[model samples]
Target: MMTPLGYSIMQALAGPVFPLDMANFFLWVTALYLGGIQAIALMVHSKWLKRTAETFLTLGTVFTFIFFYFYLNLRILSSHLYEAGELGYMGLIHALSMKNLVPAFIEFASPLQHIFFMFGALMFGLFQISDKIKQISLKTRLDSVYAVVAPPCPGEELRKAVGKGERRDVAILYADLWNFTPIAEKEGPTATMGLLNRYYALWDIVVRRNHGNIDQFVGDSVIAVFGLIGEKDACETAVACALDFLKEFPSLQADLADRRLPLVKHIGIGVHAGKVAIGELSAASGQPRVAVIGETVNTAARLDSLCREFKQELLISQTAYKPLSLEMQSHFQPMGEVLVRGKNQLQAVYGRK
Candidate 1:
């Protein structure tokens, strides 16, 4: 049984072949439908068609001509009714009655032609929906990962507000993975990245446990600050986190050796208490990054770098060292004041035994 739509196509096709010929009318309608399909095909496959539009346009014209030819033949058959003696009359009338069957057949096939175009439109619509969903999913995943792995940096207006100058003390910790560059060069990029991830994870745990937020990561170094916008006991917190990081390092080192990778068994930490201009800086790439600048951060970094010279894994400046709790002071060894380079005044530095 034919559907109503299919039957309508048949009735439209089987109309008068001469006077009032709907077939010829249908040809022009079919051509218009084909035009729409071609336009849609160009849009759906724009990337591929951009290089080949002229060729596809030429090919599309050929297909239109082929369809027209089939329509012409249907007309001849409908007019002559398949009689052996009528072949000549069929060709003769087809050429002469162009105003009849040609137009009627085109009009009849118009709906079928448009129906074919709808398939192309449907496919293009599905592709658009799929691409939209994929983009949203990718963005969502990226946002979630960022929330877990990266610290948030304040926006421009917020940084500007912070930069207006407020006097406040901050406990700062500078942590450097032991011998990172040489291990990275020896292990290759993949293994090196894996090692860094494990190392950072340990830092994350220690810092978070001690109620400190990671301020920033610079290569293999992490800067964590306590006491500032939202913290108390900043000095004690920074020292506790550094000590905890050291205790976890040896076990982590053993695990790496088991995996046939170089162990980062030791790391250097430098802690200092001082005033800092903590705010955000816009990078060259137009992304904002949290930064601590001023003498406090400089002094801390200088002390961290000095660990290699002192043959020790951790150090605390006098400002932070003196304020430590009795329990915290018990674990540290006093290394007398040293004149750090690029500084006019002598700054106190200590080592962990």
Candidate 2:
């Protein structure tokens, strides 16, 4: 549209005798080529292809601008050559083909064009490579963070509740590794950390399989919550997870022994169900960490601590026990009321026999 409009205007001013020169033709072609390349660069979704197209466009613009500048200036400074028409587009092309014989063609195609083009190309390539590296690094960091944090809850509403503070009844499961301290001390930091990671990895599988979310790992303990997203039988699910943990422990220990790492003899798990405040707590790193806090969490931790004294691998409070199916309930026997520290009333605890 602009091409026809410009031609019409030029004809109106020059009485239909407007000269069609090689420079005008070249300018029109260059503009269309650059415009087409820019459109393709914008349309492509692939990062690599988009960058390649953009680099090509940049190089084309730089080289075209340099060539046109020299071409037009040469025409103006040497009118005799233009009048003879030896410096027309085709003539210049012929000169370039025989550039070794024609020194003036060398001036038209200077070393400065190559220098600028190569510098632009190099910087564009470096910037693209740097962006790609940064993207990969960020992805790795986020993967590690997600592995350590709780798995995302299913629904958007539930996720929002967890992010903001909300009172929800959830079955809290606290599992602590038995005899880990001595093993850590004997095995040293690096080996002990590896072993601990293995144990936590196993725990993560069991908890997720039972539809529970692991909130955090504090030292040798893992705190997980079931039904935070409103599962009806959260208590039964928590008890089932504890049982699965016990069932999987022997295999884990055997694997550790095979690897020649320090072995953990047992794991103590406690499950309690009640209302708890679910919210995000700001860490020292200024990131928000999802936290479940209340008396129920404290009770569950205490019950886990009592596992050694009670000679049981799994323990559950009365609140957790009441909601279980009869078959699941039969797996435990009441250990009677015991006054746990930091509680006014004697809490009824049940131990898995």
Candidate 3:
């Protein structure tokens, strides 16, 4: 295709005296073909195609430079032949055939080659820098998500766990602010939100200190679990965590009182231990989080509800109470079996005696 195009271009430029020999004309055709391939390859998006494009670009550039230098040398040789009164196509061919092409090309192309090498190096450096910046930005965003969601372990481990899910014996702790609805209504939105923030912060501290993973916060309630990451004494740790919340309640109340905000008088916490299914759940915001669900979790929430009925700050079911140390067990007395809502059998609940 390029052969005929080159022939026509040469005829148009030189009229009846076309100067390029067959070899020179073929070089021009090869350079134009490579340049065309380079242009086409640049428009593709595939990985392999991009790599091919780069290879073609370098080859095309080299070919173009070779053609340019050779053409220039041929022109100079032909002009010399014309000046010496031996102006003929045969003279031009004979001059080109005898000339030492490699040395001439090297002499003319060395300086320009160094300049091109430096430019290529600069472009490659910039590309590497840009790629690094993009990777860092992506990592930052992922770290932010991990920090906020706070899975048992960040990165690949958490992703694998969330993917497959697990069934484990865990101690579930359910805590709800006593009388929060009236407080929210009386305080209004801004004050209510501020109070909730402080309240949740207090729970967060107490829960984390006892090695508990907060599963979710639903309205005025918080659900946390121990042994989600395979802790040995999940039940004991949960009971201790609930006790800490009771101990911290007054400080939180005092803080609210100092701030002139409507204070929640008490918080009800319930602890229960059993095998539950741990899995990922999507929030309304479309972010996935780890959570637990089963009869054990429900029993814990029911025990928390029993706090209002029993007029106690903490309630622990029999399963949770059984794992406490002797000294820890001494803190609570059995409340007897009672008909808990949504359960067929009576559940034995205990509270601090």
Q: Which candidate tops lDDT?
A: 2
After superposition, the stretches of candidate 1 with alpha carbons farther than 4 Å from their true spots are 1-148, 151-167, 230-232, 281-289, 341-343
| Alpha-carbon local distance difference test for all models | 0.67, 0.75, 0.73
Estimated TM-score per prediction? 0.52, 0.55, 0.54
Q: Looking at model 2, which ten-residue stretch has the lowest summed lDDT?
A: 93-102
lDDT of 2 by residue, 10-54 (tens): 745855444444454555677788888889976876656766776
Deviation in Å, model 3, residue 317 alpha carbon: 0.4
TM-score of predicted structure 3: 0.54
Of the candidates shown, which would achieve the greatest TM-score relative to the real structure?
A: 2
After superposition, the stretches of candidate 2 with alpha carbons farther than 4 Å from their true spots are 1-157, 282-288, 341-343
Q: Using alpha carbons, what is the TM-score of model 1?
A: 0.52
Q: Per-residue lDDT tens digits of candidate 3, residues 1-353?
A: 56667665866687565555545555666656776876776576554565555555655555555555565666686788778888876665555542545554455456777557545655665565455444444433322332222333323455465555778899999999888888788789988877777777777777889988888788789998888777788988999988888886776666666567687888898898988888776669766677688988898998889899899889999888888899999999998787754568987889999
Pairs clashing within candidate 3: none
Positional deviation of residue 61's Cα in model 3 after best superposition, in angstroms: 88
Candidate 1 residue-wise lDDT, 1-353, digit = tens:
12334534764676554322334444555556556656755475343343244334444555455555555556566556545555565554553354555565566457776556545555555565455444444433322332234554554555655564565688889888778899889889878866766667667777778876677877788888777564667888898888888876775665556456667766778888888776656679877765666677777787788888888888899889888888888888877778864567887777876
